[model samples]
Target: MTKTILITGSTDGIGKLAALKLAEAGHQVYVHGRNADKLTSVIAEVKAVATGAAVDNIGGFVADFSDLNAVRKMAAEVNEKLPKLDVLINNAGINTTASVMTKDGLDVRFVVNYLAPRELTNALLPLLKKSSEARIVNLSSAAQDPISYKAFVGQERLDDKDAYAQSKLALTMWSMDLADTVAADDINVIAVNPGSLLNTKMVDEAYGEYWASADKGANILTELAISDEFANDSGKYFDNDIKDGAHGDARGEFGQPHADALDKEAITELERQTQTVLQSLSA
Candidate 1:
């Protein structure tokens, strides 16, 4: 059966590839990007690969994840337009930016990589709950560091690497917390490190080189989003960098994330700090 899937940042990188693959497989795919023109183009590209009824079921949304207000607005749009959402892939992230801080006194990396996805997922919970089996696949990274609340709130400035790492750890931590919080609702939340330094724009800009093909990442994401293998997997981290010893393929493997992600104290504090920041944003 074809499922309704929404993938953020689908105009580029592994997200774009995954969106195209899913569409070709006949799933209803909604692609999102920060730029309207790019989103429109990607929607057309994705539709070109679609089979069956999925050709006419393509959708698109434009939202700059650095701004919480924009994320909320996009979520509202998704809620209003879609009846039920089966899968949500939070794939938008930034490593380097011209401006390190947003106008709202939050670090751009943390806002786009962590906070925005959290807000979007929470806002779409009602629609997700409507599906028989809803899955939230968060794009996390292997390069994780301990989260600094001060840096997250824009009080302490960090270099690009520190900010990006901490933001990913924050995302992984929340994925676990959210999974437990919504377990009764049967919505599975899984955080995944979609292979480090894949040949994508982000990696090309950050490292000037990539160790693997972006398809390696896209393949795992497509599986995590729709394959029955992950139907019962929730609150777990999938490390695609780990090769299957038996098959020698870089694919999905359940693995431990940052040590902080496993700490109950850290998760609770992150939850508290996130709520404080969100409330401040709303005010």
Candidate 2:
């Protein structure tokens, strides 16, 4: 069907591998990267494997996720690049050892890992709404710690902040609530835990155990992106490409056991806080 797919952070690691695999699967892949040279080479790799299909249909957008302004610009570009986006993968994120803040004064890790994707998705929601069937895949991890913006603004935690993990938790919860809100519109949002340890730069430079090859890391991502099973399932978490109770989906649950992600009350409060932060950024 040559479905159109856009993946952030497609320059390297799991993201780039996902782009390549989707390109090979006959999907038009829009690859993004912060680096121009990396984006250029990734485009070539995608084209080479995209034979028998309209190779030039692939597209690229470059933006450093670290900067909020750059993120806003990227958001605008995405709205203009594709008219009807079939899938949007919020895969671009980073983890830092120390606390840093964006120009808008949000923690660097929180902004890049969560705020960046959130802002981008909201900016493109109109175009996404235009699609008869649209899916938004957000990358989440087990170590992610649930957080409250109420606990962190102004007094924002940065020093050796576990803010990276907390940011991810916030993102997963946000996806959950958003999924429910948009389900009626025929759009689905799902959060994914790619895998446990992979030999990606994140692990190589930081934790030292990202041993899973990019191919393996990318599978769950593409599966959820193209799979039809998502119609019955939205706002759920999948680990290592498995449905609940499959293989490694069983990570110790967080928050309330009954509903581990984010519930209505928490989501409402978080959304209010998020709006306040976003508005503060603009003001």
Considering every candidate listed, which one attains the maximal TM-score?
A: 1
Model 2 Cα lDDT, one tens digit per residue, 96-183: 5443766556677777777789888888888888877788999887556667464346465644337767777788878898888888
User: Which residue runs of candidate 2 sit more than 4 Å off their true CA positions?
Assistant: 97-99, 148-151, 159-161, 241-260
Query: What's the lDDT for candidate 1?
Result: 0.93
Report per-prediction Cα RMSD to one decimal: 1.8, 3.4
- Poorest lDDT segment (10 consecutive residues) of candidate 2: 249-258
**Backbone clashes in model 2:** 5
For each candidate, what TM-score against the reference? 0.97, 0.88
| Colliding pairs, model 1 | none
Q: What is candidate 2's CA lDDT for residue 91?
A: 94
- Model 2 vs. true fold: TM: 0.88
